[model samples]
Target: MFKQKKQQELREICKSRGVSLTPQRQAVMRALAARRDHPTADQLYEDLCRQMPGMSRTTVYRVLETFEKLGLVRKVDSRASKAHYDADTTLHPHLVCLNCGKVVDYQDREFGHLEPPVFTDDGFQIVDYAVTLVGFCRQCRQDPNN
Candidate 1:
């Protein structure tokens, strides 16, 4: 249901923005929306390639870039070197596991709420922001080797 809603939202957004809803774009969005975990483009490509034999890594990277520009997704910040994407673009905090490189939405929405001034002292406009909390996840903490 969540994936369907996101796909519909993507369609509406594409239509409004005068962008063609290409198959690659649709596939990328569907794959991203289907997951709760924030995945890197390479990870997405691996999953997609099994289903879409012809899909390329470059295409996934490009489509994700387009989606980010179109406000269909958000790039999540994590300790990992590769970029991670989240389909849920709303303002919310993320809990990043330092040990396993896992990123998940922080369950408590009210915890990190913030309202910044429109302009900073240097006259830089504050358009957006993200809050990420880093720590070891339960599994990682319980693991003997980690």
Candidate 2:
């Protein structure tokens, strides 16, 4: 379950941002906030299908995109082709299980403070980034079937 305080904060942020807190969007937000596993838009739609029978895949994708734009969610970097959504937008790293496509949050203060590598000839501006460590998760590592 999502923390009550966090949910209230989200509601207030939505109100301040002038984003309509529609039922579908609210449901999606709750779903995202409740889980640590970074889920794709399709996964969220499937999870909410019973509760939001009328909701469409397009709506879920749009709402996630909007939330990402508003800084309410983070679009996690993944090896998988599908985009993953994270409600905890704080700067942190992620552990991606290649076998099962699971994403778990990893927070290390030291890691957050590490400076990026210097770029010279490329002249590319270094911005913010989320570190992703990819490997098999416990379940996958334990089960050869995976």
lDDT of 2 by residue, 1-146 (tens): 45565577678888999988788878888888877788999999989887888989999999999888888889999888999998887778888999988888775645645677666478876766778889988999999477
For this target, which candidate reaches the highest TM-score against the unseen true structure?
A: 1
> Which ranges in model 1 have alpha carbons more than 4 Å from their true place?
144-146
Worst 10 residues of 1 by lDDT: 137-146
TM-score of every model? Answer: 0.93, 0.81
CA lDDT, every model vs. true structure? 0.93, 0.83
lDDT by residue for model 1 (52-94), tens? 9999999999999999999899999887899999999988999
| lDDT score for candidate 1 against the true structure | 0.93
